[model samples]
Target: MSTLFGLLRKKMLAPSLASVGFAERGFPVTPSAATVKLEAVPQAVVCGFEWAIEGASLWELERRLELVEPEQRGFAYEGATMGYTILDAMPGGGRNRTRELLEGPGKPHIFLTYIGIGFAMARLPRPLWKNILPELSGVPYHPTMSWLAVDGYGFDRAYFDTRRWVDEQLEPEPYPWAGHPGYFSRAFDQGVGRALWFIHGGDPRAVAEAAGRFPERRRPDLWSGIGLAATFAGGCDRAGLAELRQASGPHHDELALGVVFAVKARTFSSFVPRHTMTAAGILAGLTVEAARALADRTEVAPDFDAPEPPYEVWRDRIRADFSAGDQRRAG
Candidate 1:
């Protein structure tokens, strides 16, 4: 049962179902059978957020989250973790709820959980950003994958304020997240790229055109985001995936990098959906097994002392491998 305060928090902070609808955001998503499934993704996140803010116990939360379908269960965990991050940041609410979720049943879903923390970051004041990520010593990908939070932040901004971030192509001021201030905008653009997949209702042509609207410099990161979303979220068919790849053109390697990451995340969760496999084969030119092997071989150790974050290093390694293969083919 929720306390009065918890209920109040839910009422104040949780977004309504209608708020995430395509029409509500004025996105040009044409009505179709695919649209309903695509929209449900965000609504699942909203449900998870409400449950967590309502002070549900971990066991109760796990039960509720498990009820979500396998494909979207991770996203619900994303919302719940976001809610917990918000509660932890509030005055007199330092229950370490985010830590509990991430370190416990939320472990497998750590990738999405970090993104959820970013969603909370979107709602919280800048000062509280520091408190959003909790220390998870010995956890496999704690700080390194934490950059996904920024990606999540970018997704939130673009999804909510499309005119400024997406339409106007406005760039966010840099912050020293993960101690790489310069890379912040790039990570954020990747999130915006993910949003384009949804904003365009998984239409390959629309997503490509939207990315084209941005300056040439930002398209690579945006294409990377699109690749991640296309593989992981899977809104389109095999032909559509090929179309997206063709549209990527010069940024094809970056798109493949995103596909590799998405496959790695899914493999980590121990559930590689058929669509994800199909996407990997088409977008990255790798089978699910091959993608997982590539991600494993290219994995970088978490080293904050290094010039670049291990996350980017890991990404670069993947991109380089793809480029090498392409060069060999050209020869």
Candidate 2:
């Protein structure tokens, strides 16, 4: 964010008049084996990031992300597979292709939450609207919901946050994932509940290009409100270390270490997605060990031979391991 914008954001986030909480909670953790059964499909709104390239369409962008067939990119793990989904309604065949990848015989989709086009036009500085309007004449967008404050990367946290918050507000009881009586409290208190996955090895410009700009107003504030509330509700932290270790054994150790390093390197919060750089022993795998392992080795060390899809190689492994039956209960 630009200095002017950052200051404005900070001013807005500061505790005062209507005090929307934006706590310093780290990233939330994906539940363990025992917790999976209890894990409800969160009433989430899938907010995807997109960029409107001059010549490129969302279709092409989605393909590059899927990295499917003959694309042969180094350090292949499932980053693209994790975040964002393409809407099935899109023209041409991209939607069908995405559906086949998601619902087809491939790995059971777990991480992805929604389908959206990154507002490719969002990257422009808001102040430049006057001069840029002529070039943006043909763009199609819902005026009321067109732009969302997604930070510099075009990632609008407000949509996701709003989804989660709305659920919490309207639900009669706490969410099913709330776990034990005080579980949510402790989780938020300690910062173990908020998390974001960081994908590796994508062109930066591609990402930026994909994350076009949107109107900036209450989006960031709204997202910050949800984020801060989650923090107070039991956000992510090192507290789960002992439990995570006891449940997963040596593998958990590696994951915990990696999580630690990730937090240290990226001090803002573990949820922040840095460029995909590998650090040893940090990429622990419960089910997708082969894929995670290969990813860690290649992304970190960068060695010979183009690797196969980690999900393809370890599909069975992830199915067997990370499944709901074997999940570990943090309590």
**Candidate achieving the largest lDDT:** 1
lDDT per residue as tens, model 1, 1-331 = 7999999999999989999999898999988877888898899999999999999988899999999998999999999999999888988988588898999989999989999999998999898886678999657887889999999999999999999999999998998998899999999999999999999999999999999999999999999999999998988998899999999999999999999999988988888889899999999999999998999998887874578888999899999999999999999
Name model 2 segments beyond 4 Å from true: 1-48, 51-59, 66-97, 100-159, 162-240, 243-331
Give the alpha carbon lDDT tens digit for every residue of 1-331 in model 2: 1245334533442223112111111222233431221121111111112111111233543445344321111001122221212222222313343333333321221122111212211223333322221111222111111111111112222223423422232111222111222222222211111212111011122111111121222222222222221121122223332332343232333233233322222221122222212221222222223434433332321121224222112222322343332366432
Give the distance in Å from residue 204's predicted Cα in candidate 1 to where it truly belongs.
Answer: 0.4
Give me the candidate number with maximum TM-score. 1
Local distance difference test, each candidate: 0.92, 0.23
